[model samples]
Target: MLLDELVVTADAVASTRSRLAKVDALAELLRRLEPDEIAPAIGFLVGKPRQGRVGVGWRSVGAAMGQPADAATVTVAELDAMLDRLAATSGAGSAGGRSHELRELTARATEREQGFIARVLLGEMRTGALEGVLTDAIARAADRPGPVVRRAATLSGDLGETARLALTATEAELEAVGLVVGRPVLPMLAATASSAAAALETTGEASVEYKLDGARIQAHRVGDDVRIFTRNLADVTHRLPEVVEVVRGLPVHDVILDGETLSLDEDGVPRPFQETMSRFGADAARATLLHPWFFDVLHVDGRDLLDEPLATRLAELERIAAAYRIPGEVTTDPEVAERVSREALAAGQEGVVVKAIGSTYAAGRRGSSWIKVKPVHTYDLVVLACEWGSGRRTGWLSNLHLGALDPTGEFGEPGGYVMVGKTFKGLTDALLKWQTEYFPQIEQRRTENTVWVEPTTVVEIAIDGVQASTRYPGGIALRFARVKRYRDDKRPEEADTIQTLRGLLRM
Candidate 1:
């Protein structure tokens, strides 16, 4: 996997206009790799590292390519320079020596060094294809199951690894895909847990304990050395020394806890969301910005509680925080929970996340496992079909044609969904490419280009208010049904119905 190899693949994927063809080509190229080769392969395709979740902007790529005004132009020397720099530090020493090291890598016919070096400098890799589509393509190429590919992807946090392993796999693989699957992820910051009922019914359990919010953090501690990672998994332990101090002082030594980092104002209320996000990745200024309130511990000692229920984890979390008592806070009462959550809201916090005592930690997956009940009426709709978007969406599949389940099997169309409106936000060009290709599969074409899907996706849609429209197939249409995200876990069967829409409208 030399730089040239990746460049060739990048050129192929980016230049190909047909989404299905792009997917097929990528799948074939990826299918030839070993399990260990996937990450670098993706890095090559994207022209960056697969490890970090960072996105590389064309501006930076342009800088690397020395294409001052040109946005799309990508070059190998810009990529080579990045690899040379990484080799200088992580490989050989000094600029002159680094070139020699890269030359040696080329001579050995190794793409690892070149890929890693490029990743180190490029920050991210960009290709027209997306993670999910690539996962599907990998599944098809490797002849493995889709769930297996998905599991590997979740565990590794790298889809390229999934693509790589698809080439050749064994019964006992390199990484166990279990832990990452059911790991708890924040659904969406809520205003409050309005009911113990919402938590229990949605999670299908008893004794839902409400957790307070400051900042959402997934803190991982390996040993005596403690490192705190944010929701996105970028380690910021150094930034929040005070938090590290709290974590270090805890009774439990080795564990991965999910909690929030809050910055209290002089009046003891939470700061604004913008103020909190500003504290992210800030090492020196973090002392003045934050503190942690541990709500649950997913893993402790040698045991992994990814399979353990949520209630059990929270008990241990409360006990540990209580003994250490460094910036400690925990609660089981819904009333107190409501107060804190409301306090958070008053102090500009988003809301509280309530968990069933028995819920499992589901990572990268949402829907009912941890139900988000907000004060507003919101529905997670899918981008069923799309129109060529406007302005910024020019030349891109710009406007997303939104839909809900055509549950009634109405108008001689049953078991599929229909279009209601189109949205232009929350999409990148790659996402558009995906829609253009896949959206047509379930597409019920009544007209040219503006196709329909089976409503197999879900998005968290909100409106300032709802409107009444009998003409629209949903009977009532959303005033503004914008896409929040393309939730992969949710199936089309879960899409909002005409009844649900009308219910909200009536309310």
Candidate 2:
């Protein structure tokens, strides 16, 4: 209920690694929560406001603790004073009044309260800390044994929802929110069915559809309003004005659609992935190339397709999509999926996604019932001091020098030396455009011929074979490893580590 309560728990959790100590700490923290703290805690774990189609980033703790949003616009000292005022108010008497008063204050605060808003929302209230660190601390404070929190984390769908349930419900209630016996808050998935004969073996009568090759896009439509988001949940409504406009005109009152967005070439065939991605970013030119291809409908006129089996949902979807004569989505027989996949691949499209006859829509998850079988490639390599590039890479040294990790004397920051290859490829033209614009943010310096860099980028190279080399480190070289592409989602530490390189070399 008060700021000190949460702070005390955080402090106690951070102080220990002992099991008994953590359980004791959690017990002490629990005493302070007063039940009502569950709402704010839920809000905290969710990273944004009330559940929405696409979420905003985490808001500050100061705001959550009842400080006016405007309070964030004030001086650090002023913010501190506001925190102090709430703390004192909580102790004095009228907790509800303080909450009400804080809400009123937030309404009247300055329009330009940027720092304060960031500080409060991100819980940047304490330095040298992050959500993981705090959650870990809470488990420790609870006096639980090693990884008690992590164990709890894995049991529930995710940490935030788990934490919220833990604070508000019984253990049975907690279990109720899980997949085993619970009604999932998000989407439900259908079990994978085999061939129609195999389907008869499993369910007597299974439903199936021809697998499709395209980007997975989930469309959520509420009333007259429609929102489009990616699998990872980032909103892409603006990039898809043509799409949202199409979905809106559908006769359904409210619905959720699952499908992909791709581009077709002159022959009316799907385009390459690189060409499709170009139509989404801010600097994108008009995308006459990219087009929407709807496959299945998840919801329709006041109905949710989550728990229903695939066969039933498909029948409903066909009625809805056909009613609107949706142009992009094409329904086909399951037996023809492999042939269709080859057709799409020949057209430069990704592989296909197979669906069963009685499948359910799986939201916020990578459901097994709906599997994506893409042709993926991987490589392992050691690190070498990187070379600097030009323009955007003029500073902070962006390029990398790759090597094979030596087993006997593996890599240790310039330890082994190999010269297998160098590459400035794998990046799309859109990515190149971004690097050119934002490279200055990380640049360190520049030289006449060789540029020095930050050594942060990592990439995969798809090559023919391995070969022995005199110039490169590790005594061997990648025969024709070319830059496949920059792995933007990974961190440098996670880059093919030295150990991974040894495995590749062994092969």
Candidate 3:
């Protein structure tokens, strides 16, 4: 298929606000693709190249721009081949070689195709439809159930390949894509709640496990050969030999374990999340090592337990990895759940995860079967500025630059605010419209991308906690911060102080 056809379809997809419309358009586009073009076409439609993150930064794309072709000449297969070559080029003369190849690829296309190729390479194809929407489109095009395709994609860890199969293979073939012992399946996620009692109310007689402030890991073991994958499915088997050794010591021959790993202090207390993350992604040079805590087992000895209930899986997990299991108790009482949560907090852990005892694992999506309960700190902070939105939030001011009041002019003037971080989360379309209409009235200045506003608007923000950082003048930033609401009743002087946020760091 012509590259222009795909570009036009993407532009149309981005132009609409309705998800159903986007799915229909993408489904129609999918039906037009040949069997060989399915993967690359789906990749382009979802704003990514088949060759993922091919080391092509904005500098390389910016340097390769030239006169556009007068006509549409590039095909989806040809573009995929070009990207394959670009991804394979590395070391020594790789830079010059990549530049020449990129220029040749770009020079073959017209202005529209060049822009689309740049967007795809840069990973900025901002059509509202990402993996979720495209998965739905694939299912609709293939005449298969959405859940079937979603589950297959989640287990396979490759949506492009899943899409190819869904379009070409039978439903039985798609169902046969089960959990392989070596490949990493998408880890199940949890929804957040304010307290354990509320979480337990959602899932009665639940198993509440200690939620550790650590990196998520999914370990796949086939006898002595063990592979560890991070949350995003990046293999880090070579980074932590101790982790591999621990998995090798397990009694089971083949198992897929879902768990967390964190470094501990001398007192055996869990370290801060920042410290854990730093070492988690760092080179293997540190003396401190991370300890694994298993919570769920997805597979055991060639038996796939993903379709099994949580209670069944937990029994198997306790039977196989009892020594490394996370500490918790199964309970139906809300008070017991609350007590477990308090105990987890008192032990320097993050909180507790309340899970439905009978619920099976929903791998890809953040289903409501599992709830994460943690203490939240809310404070009235000032809005420093706002930035233009994109995708569905196109014309509205979406991202808010949040700041805490510096009472003594330590960072700014007396009673001024210092920026902590930016967040576009927890904003609805109605709120976007309100910000677009109201924020400009307090406008201090305007940039091409942002609208600076006076530090008079007080907004209530809920945060997981504070982390020590050098990026902000207050020496800390809010973690997992989201807008609770706009505090119209409060003044800038009455807002929470930077000292209050910094104090949270000590806690």
Candidate 4:
């Protein structure tokens, strides 16, 4: 299929606020793709190239832009091949090779196709066709049940492969996709609650486990081999050998453990989040060893526990990895929940995650089955833009323009971020220097004082609370907002929503 067809469909999807209309438009486009073209086309529509992050930057893409072709002639397969070449370009003189290839690819694309390609390369496609909507569209195009497709996608952790199976393979083949011991499945997520008591109300008879200030990890072990993946599914087995040894010591021959890993001080108190993250991102294991604490066991000895209730899974976790299990207790009482929350905080932990005992694991979905409560009001927000610093902080990107996701277009465009407020507080000199150097690399456009960027950076912000405001499109402004930290473990789409902030008006 021609690339223009996909681009036009994406344009239509972005132009409409009605989610049904967007899904229909995407489904129509998906129906026309050849079997081999489905994955690459899906990647383009979602702004992530199947090749992953090619070494191309915004400046590199801009330098390659030239006169566009008058007509659309580029095929989906051809574009995929070009991206493959771009991803493979790396070495001493790879920069020139990448530039030449990008120019050649852009020369064959029309103006519309060129713009779309640039956005895809820059990871800036804001076309409202989020994964949920596209998953529904794939189901519609394949004439498959939505739940079946969703299950397969979640299990495999690859929507492109799921689309191929749904469209080209038989129903039985698609249904056969299950949790593999080695492959990383999407981690179960938690919604926010004001307090442990409030969270208990949402999840009755819950396991209120300690919420750690650490990196999320999913460890898969088969025999003696172990692979660790981050929240984004990036493999980091080599960076955390201590964690691997800890998982290898488990009695089970094969297991999948969901948990957190963090470096602790001599007293066993968790270190600062940044220090833990620094060790987590290292190229090799550092002297500061990270300890793994398993909270839920998804698989054990060939038994799939994902379909099991939390009570059952916790039983399995206790049986196999009790020594490493995070501290918590099962309780339904509000006072007990509050006490657990207090204990966790006193231990220097983040807070508590109250999980419903009877609820099965819902991978990748933030249902009310699990709710997290922190002492302070903190949220993961997106960095929409950054302003140049002044006075003592001159030349640095000091003030961050924060935004919340508006998934339903209640406050603005669907799948777009609504600016809620700005903050220059809580940043250290080191952070300011890093921001000054990093923000320009991802710049989409810039005014004299502000540099607009792709809404991809997630930062955790703490606030006193939110108050109704007319200055922002979301009709809410953060009160005394300050940066907690930059959430490198999260994605832009995973940021808290505008509706969530608006709901705070009630508090």
lDDT of 1 by residue, 104-129 (tens): 43333334333333444455444566
Deviation (Å) of 320 in candidate 4: 1.6
TM-score of 4: 0.76
For each candidate, the alpha-carbon lDDT, in order, equals 0.56, 0.48, 0.89, 0.91
lDDT of 4 by residue, 3-113 (tens): 999888888887766899999999988899999999998888888778988898988999999999999999999999999999998999999999999999899999999
Give the alpha carbon lDDT tens digit for every residue of 1-507 in model 2. 434344444445444545455556655555455454543433332333122211113432244343234333333233334444554553444555445544554454444343333434443332223344435544443333324444444433355555555555555554454232111123333343323233334332333333333455667677667787665455777788777887787777777776667666788765544456667543444846456666666567766566687767767767767543223222344445545555544555444445545555554434555543334436644333345544233333335456543334554444343345555545554654555455444556645644333455455666544434455544455544556666677655555543444343333
lDDT pick, better of 2 and 3: 3
Question: After superposition on all CA atoms, what RMSD does each candidate show versus the true structure?
Answer: 13.1, 14.9, 2.4, 12.1
lDDT of 2 at 398: 38
lDDT of 1: 0.56
Residue 81's lDDT within candidate 1 is 42
What overall lDDT, based on C-alpha atoms, would model 4 receive against the true structure? 0.91
Ranking by TM-score: 3, 4, 1, 2
Q: Residue-wise lDDT of candidate 3 within 1-507, one digit each (tens)? A: 988888888888887978899999999989899998998887877666668877788999999989999999899888899889989998999989888988998999999899889988998888777888899999999999998999999999878889999999999999989889999988899998889999998998899999998999999999999999998788888877788889999999999999999989899998878888887887666777889999999999989999899999999998988989999999999999999999999998889999999999888788779999888889999999999987567789989999998889987788889898888888877889999999999999999999999989998998989888889888888899898899989998999999888888766
Give per-model TM-scores.
0.57, 0.45, 0.92, 0.76
User: Which candidate wins on TM-score?
Assistant: 3
